[model samples]
Target: MTRSPVLELRGLSRRYGQTTVLNDIDVTIPEGSFTALLGASGCGKSTTLRIMAGLDRPSEGEVLLSGKDVSQKTTHQRNIAMVFQSYALYPHLTVFQNMALPLTMRHLSSLGRMPFVGAVAPGSSKARNLIAEKVGAAAEVLGLTDLLHRKPSSLSGGQKQRVALGRAMVRDPVLFLLDEPLSNLDARLRVKMRAELVALHRRTGRPFVYVTHDQSEAMAMADQIVVMIGGKVAQAGAPRDLYDRPASRDVATFIGHNAINLFQPADGMPGLHPAADEAVIGLRPEHLSPAATGALEANLETAEYLGSEIILALRSERGTEIRAIAPGDYAIPAPGSPVRLGFEPTRLHLFDEQTGKRLEVAS
Candidate 1:
């Protein structure tokens, strides 16, 4: 039997005046699963996250957590934690103070929160001790045990992010929302933190809704990916599923895990009509080859030398351009030389000319 989703967005949408920011969005996030909201800027990914966080309200829909509607609840009432791309750490607060804030507020009374009153308030010492224990454990897990006393300004970018994450962890939330959390880091640090963040998720066993515009980041980190465009959901699935079998020409071009080449039947390829009529032909660069005897004719345009492979650009007889990836050691023709390109009949993809949606054919 399949497990129920931990969270659900039912008929979610957001609109302003005549413009719709989000169009009938529906999503379900599984328990302990990492789901990425992937899209370009202004695709409403950040707006969707805000709706879930109660920072923004949906015009028509419910945000449900564990089957209960939390749409009307405040951010604190929803028991969710959020980490922003800015790291949002208080510069004056020590790592320990920042990470301990949530627990202290939850356990201490009003008087117990007063700077001096808290030192003398009854039972305040016990709450402080408990907060310390929680903060220490979180710091250890985040590899910040040695720097827990440092302020955010004194820390590195990755360190500040960890503190922000540490603050969220101490809350022990049921769900965590991250909005472009790694976007501010340098490329090298970003790669290292990606692995660390995934490990952190596994260690905590909490559900995550990560929002990012970077396709590579989503592909590398998310267990599931939701592709959004124009405030509407385009597709949601495992990273490889979207990569290998895109549902539309837009998805094909977007997943773009590799260079995707499109062609027309008029280019002289054989066995393609089932997928070519009023449909755009889709091909991965790896699926194309330069052969001695083939149906299609093209002129070599450019060859980019990647370490392990050569990416060749070509233009067909009808001026239809396509790209191909060849082995680094493969003999390459001159830029203007005429060439033959071949592809496996079974590997072609077809999409509707009008809708840009993928087409299916029976074997």
Candidate 2:
């Protein structure tokens, strides 16, 4: 039996004056799973994350956590820990101080929170010890044990990021919200953090909702990915499922390693009968190869050699640019020289040009 979602957005929406940023968006995140919301800028990915974080309110629909409605609750009321892209750490505070913020604030009253006044406040000692223990535990997990005395100004980008995560971790929330948490890092750091973040998620066994525009990053980090477009979920599924069986042309192009070769029916080939509703054909570069008796003839515009494979760029008679990938040793005609590209009919995908949606071909 399927378990209830740990986080669910039911017909969620957001609007600005005459424009609708999101339209009836619905998504569910399972417990102990990593879910990434991916899309280009202005596609409502950030807005969706804001709404889920309770930093922004939805114009309509419900935000449910573990099957209960939380649309009306504030961030403080919900058992969620959110880490922003900016890290949001205090420049003057040490790692230990920052990680203990949530717990300290929760247990101490306003007057008891003052530097000197809090020392003698009733129950302050007990709370301080508790906060210290929590902070120490979190710092250990984040490998910040030795740097607990260091402030944000002295920490590296990745260290500061881990500090921010440590602060969230001290809260021990069931749900984790990360908004492009690694986008500010360098390419090498981003790659390193991807593996670390995934390992952290697995170790903690908590539900995580991540937001990112980079499809490759999302595919690498998320157990389930939600592709957003115009404020809606264009597609959602496992990384491999989305890559191998994209439901629409937009998704096919968005989630792959390279641009998918799209062909219209007007540029027909023998033995392939596109259905009446099929207006476009989508083929990945790997599925296409140079053949002696290939159906389509095109010029080799360029050859890109990557260690194990070579990507060939071709321009057909109808002026369509197509990309095909084959073994590095495959012979390629010089630029402007004619060549034939071939593929199995079953490997081609049919889509509707007007709707940009995939069309089902009878098996």
Candidate 3:
């Protein structure tokens, strides 16, 4: 069954004076799915997220939430929860207080929010109890029950991030917007939090729009990845779809862990296909390796052992540098030794040299 879209950006574009930040952006975020908005810094991903949260407005286009146009709605009026990269927790408030702040602001009257008066004000006690229940539930889910009394100043980076997520979770929002929420954590902690976030997404059953610059993070966490380039959406689809068949040369280079080796016509063709004479060819390092009787030969320059694999850097006879992966157990050859490299022809990616667009080459 095709789930309905929870949010849609129709022809969305953001501008600052004479400068354009986002250009003709159109994206659909399906309900109960994780979608990642991925791009390098200053590519307008954050601006797109801000516009979706109603923190910023688009100069051109509409922001739709579940079929309703919310282009002009304020952040509070949109009923969307946003977790920033900074964690955004108040240092003066305990974890419980931080998590409960959103509910209190939404459910309590001005008189009911007064510290001492809130306890005795008419109808305030009931709202306070409800808030407590919700906050307690959120804290339990995030494993912060024991740290509920601690302020943001005393918590570790990961704990603070969870508190931010807890605050968002308690809102019961229609959608969740996270702007690089795990960027501040150490590498090890970031990996741990990624699993926690996936579990949280399942528990909440709400659409998540995550913004990130890290391709690995996007590939690991999102069902759909929108790769933005030059302020426009270059591609949007499943991570494997983008990885296996990129829409353009830029996407092929950006989506993979190891940079793709791009061979131009000027850089002597490997003679893999007739189409190669006029098009650029791309091959990933992992797909190319040293073979005893390989078609191409290069002089090994450097070999890096990374536990499970060895990265072999070599220069082909045509003066083109290439990187290939070898088994960790593979014997290392001396520098300047000739190495034969082989690759599966089916793995070759052809692109138009002029437009940098992908070219379809029949097997």
**Best candidate, TM-score:** 3
- For each candidate, the alpha-carbon lDDT, in order, equals 0.86, 0.87, 0.93
Error of 3 at 97 (Å): 1.6
Residue clash pairs of candidate 3: none
Ranked candidates (lDDT, high to low): 3, 2, 1
Error of 1 at 79 (Å): 1.3
- Candidate 2 accuracy as lDDT: 0.87
Of candidate 2, the 10-residue stretch with the lowest lDDT total is 269-278
Writing each residue's lDDT as its tens digit, candidate 1 over 1-363 gives: 175788899999899888999999999999889999999899999999999888898999888988998888987788789999898998788989988888887889989999997899999999888989999999999999999888889999999999999999997998899999999999999999999989989998998999998888999999899999889999999999898778888778787667688765566444345556456788888888777775567799999888799898988667778788778887888899987877786677787777888888554
> Could you estimate the TM-score for every candidate?
0.95, 0.95, 0.97
Runs in model 1 lying further than 4 Å from the true structure: 264-274
Candidate 1 local lDDT, residue 200: 88
Quickly count the clashes in candidate 1.
0
Ten-residue region with minimum lDDT total, candidate 1: 268-277
Q: Which one wins on lDDT? A: 3
